[model samples]
Target chain A: MSTTEPKRRGRRPNGADTKEALLTAAREVFAEQGYDAATVRAIASSAGVDPAMVNHWFGGKEGLFTAAVQIPINPAEIVREVLEGPREQIGERIIRRFVTVWDGVGGGQFAALIRSVAGNEQAVTMLREFVQNVLFNRLVKVLGVDHPEMRVALCGSQLIGLGMARYVVRIDPLASADADAVAATIGPNLQHYLTGDLQLLA
Target chain B: MSTTEPKRRGRRPNGADTKEALLTAAREVFAEQGYDAATVRAIASSAGVDPAMVNHWFGGKEGLFTAAVQIPINPAEIVREVLEGPREQIGERIIRRFVTVWDGVGGGQFAALIRSVAGNEQAVTMLREFVQNVLFNRLVKVLGVDHPEMRVALCGSQLIGLGMARYVVRIDPLASADADAVAATIGPNLQHYLTGDLQLLA
Candidate 1:
């Protein structure tokens, strides 16, 4: 638009277009097939681009999924980091990681995410997938916990609740609390949800 | 104005108008003054009605607040019931109560509340007041819990999260689980937040 502006750099103009096409294709494929069955190759093919573009643009399925949903964090990285820690401390790690990521970008990202989830069925589906298929799925598989489904659901509830409290509703002293404080208060309960007993739950 | 309709019942003529006026006035007063400081008399006066109309229509202050916010449950009765229970079992009572109220109305009300909360700042403020000033405020006052504010917030987070999972997202088997199962599963965690040692929360 600006005639005096320098020419667009190497492959830069169409790159965004390609990425957008892939994002659109990814949404359609993922919506139809969900996280487990929706393959990167299918998404690429649907986008009319080479399969390698999936890796080149998004680094993998999880990244592409995160991009498609506009989630602020990468599921692959978060899951990997969450699992890398000791079993007993997993909850604290989760709370810490959550606070750090959301706080790093400021709170607007999570508020936006919640608003989207509240308003959009597709967003709700994406969130459930991110929780069940992406994040907790790996954790429960590694832990070999009883009532794995319940564990995942419980974990999702607490973490999402934590996000709502801190970012969306801005409740304090929880909202103003530092990461360690949040972990200390909420982590043990999260740990219980993750690996605790359930005789009564029956 | 249907001629076929029965004579609209006794005092039915402007009763609906009075209730609507009270609701509108309650919203403005609660919005400006919050749950604790707001008065039923002020709300009734703002609606240009007798002070007794507040009690006649909405039961009391909590009823008026819930009505103004279009919340499905009565916070006064809930707070009363939650407080009437033994201290140790308060958490189970909470989970059970929450599930029953939402389930009784079907899941639509909680989902609608979340949607409203997500979309409206005034809704957010009202919810915060409902949590801090109405529900947890009394519980904390009675139980004398440490870090009362944090406990209130943590409770808010988990309960709201549970509502989202069970009703909005329908993340089973927690979503499909009966009230007893949910109470058994999530109750202790709530108890911990309610009256457990919060030493590390500092």
Candidate 2:
């Protein structure tokens, strides 16, 4: 019984350790070589693990990236919260939510992501996926607006720009302004992107 | 008399050559070490000119940078164009102007500026000053809106964000979308930031 118990414990811990090693290796590889240049084999080799382990654990490079740079907040939950609110105030609520999460909880991860984005194609891809696939796609679907992609892109640009100014570039007034104040000033524009007329070409 | 004239010509050409040398050296240094890490002395030495020449021609490193990365388009001219139109269409015109400048004429310089901004504080400072002092302050004054700074900042965020996505990050749809389409979609939001009612707190 004792021997069996030890073996069971060893199996689980080994899996956890391999996952951790892959994550650490992946971050270093991504930082050094960037997203496009980083390969699964290299990440695995750096971790001293078999290349297949990456697929087994992360499914692929994109999944591995998502795990590596995961924000603390869940996109689905934010989508639900924004969608649950009064439809008219959805824009205000969404901007306020972004300011809160990005300022406090997700600030560090976001900064790291934004910093990596300048010269790194992978970082840019990761950012695009998170904004497009994770956040805006779901929101746009819920809104059922015309030219949903364009609408989402516009909203994404504004929010990402707000993040860039406030955090990355540290533009003044905008950077130091109170969160609610920013939301109030910027929220209407977001709302316009969401439910307002986009006037996209056919 | 011939000897005296030759010496005079020699002195003027030397001065112009030194100034030109400093400008070339400054661009290389700024690109390699970024704006903050680069020094006037280093730029001068790289150019094989006396360090004081940097101050003589450019006034300082900041002036040198302004000269190096100067955007071809005049912000004041764009502001005039946007404001001179029918008040209702101001947003559309402004966004159209931004898309045109960034996509074509000023694309390369803007890309360099935005790319450097990630790790370079000096680039950020330059961008902030250009947006605040040169562009938005004048536009806000023309509009005479309340919370003028905030309004300008908001406008700056959106425009900067569009530039980042389309040029730097290269996000699709927004990146590839026609300028007129983008302007139509994003224009109203700018209009809102400019002349629309902003629900700012007291």
lDDT of each: 0.81, 0.78
lDDT, residue B61, model 2: 88
Q: Pick the candidate with the highest DockQ.
A: 1
Model 2 clashing residue pairs (backbone): none
List, residue by residue over A76-191, the lDDT tens digit for candidate 1: 78878888858898988998999988897687667766766675666788788888888888889888998898899999999988998898888899999999999988999999
TM-score of 2: 0.77
Docking class of predicted structure 2: medium
Candidate 1 chain A worst ten-residue window by lDDT: A29-38
lDDT of 1 by residue, B1-202 (tens): 3325534566575888998899878766765554555678888899999988888877887667667655556666787798786888899889899998888868766776676666567678878887888788878878887788989999999998999999877798889999999998898999999999875742
Q: Write model 2 residue lDDT over A1-202, tens digit each, in one string.
A: 3545565566687888999999988877875655666799999999999999899889988788788876445888999998886787888888888888877743544555665676566667877888888888998898888878777778878887998878766666888887788878787778888998777767
